[model samples]
Target: SVCHANSIRAEQAETFVADRLKEIVQLPEVLPRLVAALNEEIVRQSQPLEQELVVLLERKEELKTKIEKWEAALEDSPELFPMLKDRLDELTEKRRQLHIRENEILGIFQQGEPIQVKDVQRILTSLDRFLAQSEKKQIKALYRTFIEKITFDPNHKEM
Candidate 1:
C-alpha cells in the first residue's frame, strides 16, 4: 500500500500548507504587501514586453520611411526599379513581421489586469473556501496559482 501511503502523505502536506497560508492571509498587512508584490511582479515581467514593443514600433517606422523613399525613387526613375524592388520588398516584409509581433505583445497586455487589493482578498477568500472542500484538483490548482515552486526534501521528509 505504498501508493496509498504516499497519497495520504501528500494530502496531509497540502492541508498543512493550506492551513499555514490561511493563517498568514488573515493578517491586516498581508493583503497590501501581497498586492504590492504581485504588482511589482507584473511590472517586472511586462518591462521586456514593453521595451520590445517600443523597439518594434520604432523600427517599423524606420522601415516605413525607407520603404517610402525606395518607392518614390522607383517611381522617379524606372531604370532603377529592378534594383530597388528587392530591398523594398525586404523592408516591407520586415515591417509586416514587426507589426505581427507588436500585436501579439499588445494582446498579452490586454489580457492581463493590474493586480489589486480586492483581487488578493478575493483569492484569499477562495483559498479559504476551497481548502475546506474535498476536491483535490481544485486544491492543487489553487496552490499552483499562488505557489511558483515547491521544494521537497525527501531525505528529511520535509516540504
Candidate 2:
C-alpha cells in the first residue's frame, strides 16, 4: 500500500511538472523577439569593448616601438644605460597592462552563439511529445536533463 501510494504521488508529480513545462514552452511566438533583443543587447554591450580593444592594441604597438628604441639606445649609450633601462621597464609594464586589458575586453565579447528560434521550436515540440508519452523512468530522466531541483510548497500543494 505504501509503495502504491508513493507510485501514485510520483505519477502526479510527473504530470504536474510536464504540464507546467508544456505551458511554458508555448513561447514560439515570443521567442524570436526575445532572442533578437538578447542578441542586440549583447552586440551593443560588446561594441564599446571592441573599440577599446582596438585602441589597446594600437597603444601596445606604440609601447613596443618605444621599448625597441630604448633597447637599441641602451646598447649604444652605455653612459645613459640606467635611464634607458628605466624607460624600457616602464614601457614594458605599460605593454603588459595593455595586454591584460585587451584580454579582459575580449573575454567580455566571448558570448555563446545566439539561439535560433526554429531550433528551439523543434526541441519544444519534441519535449511536448516526450512528456505526453514518457514512462516514469523516462520522465525522471527528462527532469534530470532539464532541472537541477524542484521545490514544493506544502501549504499550497504545489511545486
lDDT per residue for candidate 2 within 121-154, as digits (tens), equals 7787888887678787777887877776556655
- In terms of TM-score, the best-performing candidate is 1
- Model 2 lDDT at residue 71: 82
Expressed as tens digits, the lDDT of each residue in 27-127 for candidate 1 is 86877887888788988999999999999999999999999888888888989988887898899999999999999999999987878788778877876
Number of clashing residue pairs in every model?
0, 0
Off by over 4 Å in 1: 1-8, 110-112, 136-148, 152-159
Which residue ranges in model 2 land beyond 4 Å of their true spot? Answer: 1-24, 116-159
- Can you list the residue pairs that collide in candidate 1? none
Residue 22 of model 2, lDDT score:
73
Question: Each model's TM-score?
Answer: 0.74, 0.56
Clashing pairs in 2: none
- Model 2, residue 94: what's the lDDT? 89
Q: Tell me how far the alpha carbon of residue 50 in candidate 1 is from the true structure, in angstroms, after superposition.
A: 2.5
